[model samples]
Target: MIEQEQAAGLNRQQQEYLDVQGYLLLEGVLSPSEAVQYRQQLLALAAQEPGRINPTQHVRWLVNKGADYRKLLLHPAVDPWFRHLLGDDYALSTLTSNVVRPGAPDGRYHTDFQDRVPEPLPEFPLTANSLWLLDEFTPENGGTRLVPGSHRWRRRPPPDLAVHPDEIRIAAPAGSVLLFNGGVWHSSGANTTDRERVCLICFCLRSFMKPQFDFVHYLSDEAYAEATPELKRLYGFTAWPQPVDEPAAPKRRL
Candidate 1:
């Protein structure tokens, strides 16, 4: 059974909603100005890499690209919930952004960690995700769709299950953050509008899991030096250390 600690970052009502629905949308996590700033930054970055700006553009390793990106790693609004769900030792798996352009088709309905885990998914969450809405999400603008309580299914959705009957499209203003369990069934809605939809995805996993990006090696010396203790932990510094073998004696027999 999942722990129901009253001291967790979320209040009882918010916690209950997540437990029953498998996801929660926190409004006003970012101010309107902040959201606009992030949206512009992401678009500018996307422009630099035209090859990636397809129907759905993905900009990866955001933390390495800018100081602003690093701030979201420990954003006050969402940090506590991560600790409550994944524990203090959880590590960031990936910091990336997704931009769904106009005319983009609907994404497949699936769970986040489905590919990594086995059948009969574990009761406890192995990972969690936060979608920082840089643009207002609307039914006509490629908002995300999710099935309530799908996290408890303990199995992956059928390949033929194009759309679940219970699936609902999210509609929210910019600056809202959607937090969900990794096992929840979800997909991105098609963008029928003329404008592009953008969001920053912060996917996190238990410290034991292998992160999507090798942040430890990829993080620059300058960035690492400037990182706070909490940020260092989020970057996987607190994960179990890998064993390093000593060099073998120089070829004495040669």
Candidate 2:
């Protein structure tokens, strides 16, 4: 758990909202120009992929993409929540961008950690996700749909249900961020507009949880060398034991 002093980034009201509503919208987390730049960069990367589909596209492992993407690993507006929810040693599970094309359909409602953890989810959050909006989010433009207060449900949404009565679509400006507990039931809304909706997903989990990608092993040497200590920690380099062959080096705790 994070010490009270260290978790001072959020105020009592904000904390209460998250604890009760399961999600919080942080507006103006990025400047309008920055959001536009990220959108362009992500789209350019997506365009490079072969056999790309129209409905939706996911550009994964963004930390290796560029310096702009790397800066997001420790964005001041978003990092504190990760520490508050997952404790001081939280590790980033993945940094990926999601593009919902004009014809994209509504996504399935589910929690980020439900598949990994057993049924009857824990009372506390095990994971947290921050959606950095690169374009304005609207109901017609595939804004995220979430069931308020569902994080405390302690179970997954019903598979057969198409939409819950309590579900509400989130609408925010381009530079805003939607931060939520991993247990909240949510889905990407359908995109009916002519333009595509873009957002960078920064997902973090407790240090003990397995990450979606093995960033420590797969990260390029250059990237590792350039990473700051906080980035290294977020990449989970110190959260687990490293493999060794022959005689092991001097033992040390993570």
lDDT top scorer: 2
- lDDT per model vs. reference: 0.87, 0.88
Model 1, 119-203: lDDT tens per residue?
8999988889999999999988999998999999978888778889899999999999999988899988899999999999999
Clashing pairs in 2: none
lDDT by residue (65-169, candidate 2, tens digit) is 877888888788888777778888899999998999998989999999668578799999999999999999999999999999999988988887789999999
List the pairs of residues colliding in candidate 1.
none
Please state every model's RMSD to the true fold in angstroms: 4.3, 2.8
- TM-score of each model, paired residue for residue: 0.92, 0.93
Task: Indicate the TM-score of model 1.
Answer: 0.92
After best superposition, candidate 2 residue 15: deviation in angstroms? 1.1
**Residue 54 Cα positional deviation in candidate 2, in Å, after optimal superposition:** 3.9
| lDDT score for candidate 2 against the true structure | 0.88
